[model samples]
Every structure is written in C-alpha cells, then in structure tokens.
Target chain A: MPTIVVDVMPKPEILDPQGKAIAGALPRLGFTGFASVRQGRRFELTVDGEVTEDVLAQARKAAEELLSNPVIEDVVNVAVLTESAQNESQSA
Target chain B: MTAQNTELPLIGDYSTAGPVLTGARIGVVTFPGTLDDRDAARAVRLAGGEAVPLWHAEPDGAAALSSLDAVIIPGGFSYGDYLRAGAIARFAPLMDAIIAAAGGTAGNDAGLGGSAAGLPVLGICNGFQILTESHLLPGSMIKNESLKFLCQDQVLRVENNATAWTREFSAGEEITVPLKNQDGQYVADEKTLDRLEGEGLVTFRYVGGNPNGSRRDIAGITNAAGNVVGLMPHPEHAVEPGFGPDSAAGMRLGTDGLGIFTSVVASIAGGAQ
Candidate 1:
C-alpha cells in the first residue's frame, strides 16, 4: 500500500490572515495547543505506484513542483505510511 | 449600489453595441479603496458594453445583478485595509453581486458545468486573492518579491489569452502594465501548476523579471472553464489613452486593457456562449 501526505503553507513572504485569526482565537477557545499555530492544509492520499525510494522522491518533487508554491512557503515533510500503522491509528 | 442608481452608468453603449463588441454588460464593482474600478469600467465601455458600478456594502442589491451580463472585481484595499487587503472585504455585501454573477453555486450547478456561457469573473490584484478566499478562483496570492511593497510597470506575455477576459490578446502577445503590491506572490503546488500549464490554463507569465516572485512567474491565471481570471497587475490602470505607464512605442502611450472587458462583452452579445 502507498500513502501520500502533504502540508501547504502560505509563503513566508505572504502574511497568513487565517493563521493570525486562529492564533488570536486560541485563548478564547481554551485550547493551549502550542505557543504559536500556523495554519495549512493536510491532505492524505493513496497512490497507485509501488512504494520505492525513487517513487517517493518523485512524489516529493511533484509536491514541491506543483503542490506548493516555492516563493511563499516550503513543504515540511513527506511520509509514506504502511497499512498496519495506518490501521492501528485508524482503529484506535 | 444597484444599477438603479441612475447617477451611475447604464448597461451597454446606447449606440450600436459594435458588431465585434457584442453589447456585454459587465459590472465594475467599487469599494472605498478600489484603485482600479474606473479603468475596468472604461474597458467595459470600450469593449462596447455598459459599465455598471456595484457598491462594496450591499446586503442584497439585485438591481446590479439584474441589469448586468457579467462582473469584474476590480482591485483595491476595501474597508481601509484594517484586517487585510481583502480579508474583511471578502464578506462585503457587494461581493454578493459578484458571487451571484459567478452563479454563486457551491458546485457546478447554476449552469457553470453546463453549456451556460459561464459567467465571467475577472479579479485583478487584491481581487485575485479574494477570489481564492471566496473559492471562486484557485490558488492564493502572497507577498511581493523583495519582501517590501513594490510599485512598477511589468511586462507579461499572454500565455493563455484564450480566457474569457483575455481573448482580445494573442497567446504570445506581450503586454506591459502596472504591478504594485506587498502580498502579491502567487503560490500553488507543483501538481497544480503542472496541471495549469499542461492544460493551457496559465494565462499570463511575467517577463523581463519576476518582480513579485510569483510561483512559475505566473502573472495571471484562469479557472477550468476560463471564465474566472485573477491577476496581480492593474489592467484597469492601463485602459486610458495618453495616460497609464510609458509604452514601448516611446510615447506616454498604453495598450488598451479594453481587451479584457471587451472579450466578455463580445461573448455575451453573442448570447452567453
């Protein structure tokens, strides 16, 4: 099984209004989740390609090349999760 | 304000709406800080259609919608730039007119996916960023290149002039216009960029230099159906003659940004196709 995950952030040069609003609202919401909260999109997808290092590299490339904007933000990390780990997390 | 504000402009030119122009009625919305609505309106007028003014704060202004064929969200910092350039303005009453012009459908309903001529929505500069938040246009607009606000003329080669707003210009034609913004960078994923480029959706590409560091140096982009267009440059500022920036012709000339307004007017005159 193949797993795909991505996080998208507004480029550093670009200000994040949504993030600011969330950060400002955290105190009222009563969730001290962290010192600061940067908002972004997290997408979990399953691909059809066989799990390989090259495939992973290409996948990461695809993310940076088209999935995210290089000027304003950078991709934090790319990971491939196995079925058992996925199921363990899903079940629990 | 609604189109009934007779003090404002009417729909389409009173004269022959021009065979090529096609009598398309496009509403040019104006906010308090709207810096480019005048030019957008002129472009609509030059393109042989009536240019209507839609107010920024209108809970329900059906008159503006009922009298127009399409809408243009001109650029500017609405609400005095307190929250953000477009952050607070996104929830404005006038945008409802725009949302309605774009069919305001959650999905492809309201005839966007169907054969309906696809209500053309052009968002320039701050307007582009709003389109993203509004979920009308794809992608997002970020800060400028040098991290400092910039104001200068930029040249961009029309990559997909086939868009609903850019049909007057050729795909390869080079057009120079003003680009001034702090958070003007455009960011989207590589896959999305590839799809945009692969599918001929990349409308305009910055040439000479990437002033704002837009991803792929994309100056402008369009939605899947080519109806929605969003860009950073101020095309409205370039519409007037003897005004605008210095032209390549060596005089204080400017290319008529009228093509943007005209393209849609022509389409509408042809009966919304």
Candidate 2:
C-alpha cells in the first residue's frame, strides 16, 4: 500500500510560540549556530492500492479542509510517499 | 441584602413568572471532549428556553437542526486539542449543518449572505475555535501569549447589542464573566479586524487588560447578519447567581451572563412577532 504525506506549517506571518520556545532552548542545550526553528506537522495517509491522481486530489482536499487550517497554518506539501523516499526519511 | 437572606434562584424559575416564549428550543451541541454543554443547557433553561442536546456526529444535520430555534457550541478541549483546537471538529456533520443554518460556507467570507437568515448560533471558547475553523466566524484561536492556560474573571464591554445573542444588553455595557482556556488568543488579518470594527460586528471587548493577547482586545464578535456570535469567555458559567463571577452588587451575584440567553429568547420571540 502506498501512503500520502501531507506537511503543514504555521504561516510565516503568524506567531509560532512552540517553535520560538524550541529556538530559545537550542543555545541553552549547547547547540549553537542555528538561527531559528519552526515546528510543523506531517501526516501519513495509507492507501489500500496504487496511488492515483484521484486519490492524490482527495488527499489534497483533505489537506486543505482538515489537515491544515488556512487561517493560521498552510499546507506546505502533499505528495505520494515513494518506497525509496520513505526509507530515506527513516534512515535520515 | 445579606448573603443568608438572598434567596438562591433555582433553574426554571422563569417558568413561574409566565415565561416569555413558550420554551424556545435551543440546541446545545456536544462534541467529543466538550466541557460546557451542561452549563450552557442550564443557562438556556434558566433563560426560559428548552435545552436540546445535539451530537456532533449526527448523520442528518438538517434533521437535527430543523426544529431548533437556536444552537450553542460551548467551550472545551474538543478532540483533545489535537492538530490545533477545533481543526478536526470543523468537519463534523453537525458543524456543516450549523454553518449552513447560520448563513455561512466553508472557506468563505462570513460577511456574505446565505439562505438561512435567522437561525441564532452562539459559540463560546472552543466552540468559537470551531466556528472560526468552520468559517462561520473569521479569525483563528492560538495559544495564549503567556504560554499558560488562562482562567480569570474577565470584564467585557458589550460593543454591539443588536445581535441575536446580545439584544438584552445595551451598547457599551460592561459585564464580568469567567474566561478559561489554553488556546484563547484570537488572530486575524488586519483587514478583517478593521472590517469587523468598521461594521460594528465586534460584540465584546475586554474592559481591562487583554487577557490572552487577543488582537485589539477583542473578546467576541458576530457575523454580518448578527445572528451568529462567537466569544472566548464562558458566559454560561456566569448565568447562575451563586455560581457566577463577583460583581459590585455582591459576591457571586453577577448574573450578567444571563443576558446572553435571555437576549436570544427575546430575539426569537421578537422574530415571531
């Protein structure tokens, strides 16, 4: 079964307090040279069979309507998760 | 009056006073993790209206709302506040019906007029989040700027009293109510905020300092038609005399929040006239 991956992030104009707190903690934890940090969410939706355009379109609609709030967050990415990419993400 | 001499008013006390409207059917929606439905229903009963329970997952949203004169989406951590508060609950079947009945559409400007002209709806706290998520109201709620859960007796200025939920209040009336929430800060584009102010759609403004860093100290707002209103404060908690916030009159004697419920009933009654 193939999986659809949706990535969502707080809009740049909106304040990201969680990301700000993480960024503030980096130097205290001995991690240096990082300018800032922005946290986001990634959702993996499993499909029973081959990933099709229709399925991808439905996933996109879901991403816009449910996964990400267009008011404060943006749907950054919506794509099929290839096996190689999944392994790469796991290894990384 | 002394505390001992003050008679505590029980729920449905208005029935003995020859109730204004013959039990306006007000539906209170209960989403998973909702915390204030009971309080909201009590407020309705106290205001001389019948409280009807509506489930979020009701398959026939139209059928559920057909007989309802009004609906309330009370405060709570719906869906455990996952993936942003009220984000997932926005897609519930009941919300779809609410959006339609309140003259709203998904991802559309709330100012646009729709078919249903006057089904009164009030969303409080998490309910306000769902309204924004459903686009029945504009703007979104985020974490408090202090990054802490806020619970306080908040004072609010009634900016507009013509809305269906505020008809009992006079413009600029100050009322105190309990406000408790994590994601209570309301945010929106400057244009939208300006438009809300320009249109007199702002229903409530924090009288004291901004509690959650909400833009312009906005505590509540209503839609274009004035039938739908949303606020972050828990007015339902302040409807009862002994259980409400303190006021200059006496301790726990502030029933200012009752106006919201009474106002709706009055609006319904007036609409039928």
Interface RMSD of structure candidate 2 (Å): 0.8
Go through the candidates in order and give each one's DockQ.
Answer: 0.05, 0.68
State the lDDT of candidate 2 residue by residue for B93-163, as single tens digits. Answer: 67777887777774123332334465899999999998888888889988898878988899999999989
TM-score of each: 0.67, 0.89
**Per-residue accuracy of model 1 over B1-273 as CA lDDT, tens digit each:** 444455434222233333334556677777667777766777676667777667766545555566667778877776665533575666676665565556555333322232145668888887887777566766767556456788888888888877778887877988888888877878776777899889888888899988877888998888888888888888777766677778866554775465676677766765645
Provide the overall lDDT of each model, using Cα atoms, as 2-decimal numbers.
0.71, 0.85
lDDT of 2: 0.85
- Quick one: best DockQ, which candidate? 2
* Interface RMSD for all numbered candidates: 8.8, 0.8
Q: Could you say which candidate leads in lDDT?
A: 2
